[model samples]
Target: MKKYVMAGAISSILSYQACVLAQENQSKSDFSKQSYFLDGFSRNNLDQEKVALSTHASRLVVQLATDYQQGMAIDWADYLFSEKLDGIRAIWTGDRLITRQGTPISAPSWFTDDLPDYAVEGELWAGRNRFEHVMSVVMDDKPDDMEWGSIRYMLFDLPNQPHDFVTRFDALVRFVDQTAAEHIQYVAHFPALSESHVQSLLTKVDQNGGEGLMLRKMTGGYDLGRSDNVLKLKLAIDAEALVIGHVEGKGKHEGRMGSIVVKTDDGKVFKIGTGFTDKQRGTPPEIGSLVTYRYNGYTKNGIPKFARYVRIDKSKQ
Candidate 1:
């Protein structure tokens, strides 16, 4: 039996040290700030070892296109699938559990006191319908006792195994089956090898008020950045970026007119002024939307380029 060091039980009241630590890492602005600054193709290779166990934004899963059923994609035909989670995305570096964004998750000692020495990626879920509640519960360093009991830390990926994702996932399933912990369970990964299959799943998820599916490759190493091996198949056109600056208006767009400059994690910036109606422009997106701007990919940077505004993403708010 592998025994990992578990942090002492968390109290309902957070300690002064925890408060100070949270404040230090807290961002000044969630709107204009680059919240999801990591979901993209890396210009340079990121050092995975440099990433801390607690940072949620450090790791990325490879996205395998549904079209790619052969070659490396089939390496895990028996490995992946879709499952609804009413929790937050998390990763375990064997010893500690951290949110996808790198924040330390104050998981209850009882939840992960006996987890194996492997890095697993999944969600700290509460229920299929308690999505936001679970999200809120997991984000707090001082987790609520009542909420904690309602949540389950589901494990999906095993990082310590040197085998490909297929092999690693096999080990993960076995570990989950062998342990058979009460709340802990493994998420089944399904294969959507066609556009219709992917779209059908998306529709089903959306209709059921569920998020989209995660497409992962079977043959790739866990490299950072937006790799084709790991793609998020969602119905919405969402992207998070930094508000570099605001674009000036032209013609009737003078003064209170114009678009806003936004940059993705890969340093791709563009002016997005279209998509907005008069009411939207009047109040603008508060200089930042952290939004999902829709466009035709009219430019070289894979952005809408001279794109228009879309609705502000309140979920990210």
Candidate 2:
């Protein structure tokens, strides 16, 4: 009888421990699923590290645009073209501004005091061709008050709204008008242009140091991630690649870094030697870091032509 009692006690203890372990594992699994679902991402598609790092604290995710090809057939009349501002993409969550990557912006209180309680998606712009300046101002943990004064929250879209593009644009315009805030302004969307007219506009914008153009389908709804309804038209094709190795410099650049060997997401390997400043060559993008590069187009053998290093994607880290 004594032996049977002891055995029963041991079995109960083991069962309790097993139950606790199962509960812990289920809790972890639930947390992971919640994180991915909130961020509008799929756990199956992303790696473990990315899934762990994903955050949707802002409760908002902006829609992304696809690249536009020259002479691509589309209904021009159904789209609204706007100047692609060379600045950081920021999402205004009514109370505060957050980067597209979910990092919070530390703008001065006065900057957001006039914004509405609803969310607005736009870019933190510092005029045309002032990307670096805008980045310098907003990237700081504590933004500089005077520097932020020059920055503008260029309103573009209203995410999560049920209205079509035209209705949303009008609503955004009215909201900004009512606020009467200097730092907040609507991004002017131009009417559709002919193919020749688009080329002319691109030339003019390029000459003025603009980045490119964004075409928003007037009939489409705002959707998360890259959408076919929206397109980015740029002269040079730009893409992000992982830096795998570096080559030694020669001649004038001897003793310093030369070029970086990179592999695209599609497994295309290439080396970018140009577009690096002296400082960049000294401290090149570390191996395993993602870097953006610009190229004219792809060669017949699937190689990027005139590949030039653009910038390191610091957000990936």
Candidate 3:
């Protein structure tokens, strides 16, 4: 039997460290549960590595996107737009795949065996608008073969490649073909036709139940932190906040949770009363769970206007 060596985890919790060292082994010395923790194409390649396991997975840094302005004065032609996937951010560090927070995902051997021996950044997507389902499958400590079989590693970027975005993506395509892994795919990128074209594309995606479009500057290298070079445009912007408190519902919603009081990273606090299903209202996100929410622009008081609950990250669940 092949064994995955999980070492050097920095988590303060002893159980978490034990889980990491155990490599999801629960019974029969096999991976059982995994805790987990994409793109579009066109201008060049939908195109997109593997290496030894690194205890340093927690240190992985990824380039993040900034909100796109409606009429920003940048050359649209320089950008490659693709769908903004609502999948978990995962980095394949040669030998092992780890989540954004550096925890090993309990994936089956056949699922990851054919992956390259270098670094590739992408999403573990189940399908369109299935974020909640994806979370349930990917976060469980025990690995579910059937559910994992339905997931795909949708590649979008080559983090360590010295080349620019276009070249890196082209290389990623070749890399994916080399592995011939059925679950691995490349996201296609499209060139900008015009402002109206961009808006039309955005609307088309939104209408189809997709979240939004990501604009990547073809000439830009993969740089970490928020940058204008990579922008996100969605119908209603989504962000993450920590659950602080819950308010009791009144009127028709009386007795259950009326709303969840959440605090953003910037220290702003607000209540989200909408977007919860009956089941969700009965079991509102627990205090301290980081939750994702959608909202329009902020109000005069600097609050996220019309803020509504989305799903919480699997780790928090």
CA lDDT, every prediction? 0.54, 0.70, 0.72
**Tens digit of per-residue lDDT, candidate 3, span 33-72:** 2210012333243222233333443555667798988888
lDDT of 2 by residue, 229-290 (tens): 78998888778999999999999999888999999999999899999999999999999999
Q: What lDDT tens digits, residue by residue, belong to model 1 across residues 21-131?
A: 122123223111211111222313322342233223454332223423223333333223354443566777767876655557787787787676656777776555566
Q: Candidate order by lDDT, highest to lowest?
A: 3, 2, 1
* TM-score winner: 3
Report the CA-based lDDT of candidate 3 relative to the real structure.
Answer: 0.72
Query: Per-prediction TM-score, please?
Result: 0.55, 0.78, 0.80
TM accuracy, model 3: 0.80
Which has the higher lDDT value, candidate number 1 or candidate number 2?
2
Which ranges in model 2 have alpha carbons more than 4 Å from their true place?
Answer: 1-60
